[model samples]
Target: MDALLILSGIVVAIIGWLWLVITSLRLPVGKLLLAALLPVLTLFRRDQGYARAPRLLLTAGCLTLLVGLAMLFHLHPHRFEKLVTGQWQPDQNRSQTIDGEIMGQRFRPERVFWRGDDLVLEEGPSERVRRSLKIRFAGAGALLDDASIALLPNDPGAWPEVIMQWHVGALESPGLRRVTGQYSLNLDFAPAANSGATLRLHLTLPSQHQTWITGEARLDQTPAWLEQVRQQQSRSTAVRERTATAPRQSGERPVARWQAISVLAVLDEPSVVGDAAVRVTTVSGRAHEGRFKGVTDEGRIVLAQAHGPNQVDLQFHPVDIRLLETFQSPR
Candidate 1:
């Protein structure tokens, strides 16, 4: 519908300009160019003679109206495209971000990340109009006319399909606040743990006249992916710091880098240090690769499990401990 409207508008504009040029070419070529290109100037050129002046003025008025009408359409929001259906599937690792689907067919998202409880998804829509139209501007007085609607979709009809920009995570719900990045969209709600392993997201059209899309994804690996995203952010920060101070250490050897590690534990449960990738060994030749939380108090070592957000204080003793080695950062 949008394409048809634009195509027809262009055709009409071209025909109108051509007709004006041929019909009024009896005047000097320079005057004809001025009248056609800058119709408003024709209004001031009454000296061109009253013979064709009124007709030319009338032509200028009509042309001005036509241009203004086109501008009005361009400035307002209009439909862009029609979505078939949408779906999402987990990546090969079954964690991190998932692949997108259109009408049960596989597709891809431009970018994906986790921000707090919401999973962010982003995809660039094929532009029906020029890219510059998406940018909004502001200025004093008439300059404001050059501005655009910030929330307006580049393709008006597919506005609902632009999940990232619109934050359309649920049906008929307000969009969630975007944390960062253009085209990034945050899911309004996270899946409840007991709600089942499969998490379903529904996207409804704001127009309320189009079909809604649903995407079901796995939640089991979401937490792990969230942790990975945080780790990436930490790495990025460190790199930026290194880059900023590069000039000062131009001839020096790179310094050893160490990551901040943490002991993650649930209340009343043993605190786990590192995962399988990292191994911790004791003096007794005992090697452990999983979570192990022991408390040291006075002269005894007490071990227990943990859960939730609570902390436990227990006694611990150093008995024939051999070694405590960590190859990677702890979570």
Candidate 2:
């Protein structure tokens, strides 16, 4: 459907341009030929009278000329370039990445920004959830501005969601144009399971042309170790409360109580450091797997060092409310 819409739009634009040229150029040779051909063709077909034939043929010829010009000049070259290159190059000094977790699962790439290119995200990994992504102001052009990226879940009945937005510059010249925009990924995951996700990238140019690409990856799985730590913390907390309330027996050195409390607190702390195990995937499809240990604070997980070629320092934040709720809920 999208392809059809785009094709139709291009056709219409070309026709409009042809009309403009027909009126402005007013080529007598072309006009005369069209005027004569129309009446003859109409007479043979036994259709309309000779009068209307000339006007209809003239209109069609003009439209054809406009389309020819558009095709020859390729009004929107950037869009075509993207289709061939499959890479978006926005202006310099514009780059960003949005990171957040989906239900405590993993720090997924929520959005990526590079100048004016707005890359939309889509559903790719699991089937349990849907995500919408949008990117605004994809690339610079002569007269085009304002671009967007949208992601729809696999469910055919579901509606599309906007995930990114940015302003595009107008298309005016033929020189190298640049655009910058942010790519944002938005997902609504199922309560306790990992859901699949996808990202869609789009680049639009001045000539009303666009290029689309897609990338996909699974959300990181929550480490079972984290769950164990939480459970231990809960038990320790309960033990402390009971001990605190049980009025310390006459002089029973409060040392015992303090010892127990310390043990409990330690049990609840996460042992993984940014230097623990780390997994890295490069654009070349090569997997460099290692480990890195790091510390987490205020729901943000950060890596401190890389254990190998596949490991790198990265930060992740909890963004999945449902996952957090389930994790905290009594099992």
Each model's TM-score, in the order given? 0.28, 0.23
Expressed as tens digits, the lDDT of each residue in 1-331 for candidate 1 is: 4344445555554555555556657888887887578744555566573245345545554555556445434442222211112223323553323344332223344334433333444443444211101111111111111111111112211111232233222222333221111221212223346642333334333333232334545544444433454455467667857865666456665553333233322112334432223233334332323233343333323332122232222222245233433344223
Residue 91 CA displacement from its true place in model 2, Å: 31
TM-score of 2: 0.23
Instruction: Give residue 292's lDDT in candidate 1 (0 to 100).
Output: 37
Model 2: per-residue lDDT, tens digit, 51-92? 443344444554554554355335434344444466456434
lDDT of 2 at 56: 49
- Each candidate's lDDT (Cα)? 0.36, 0.33
Q: How accurate is candidate 2 locally (lDDT)?
A: 0.33
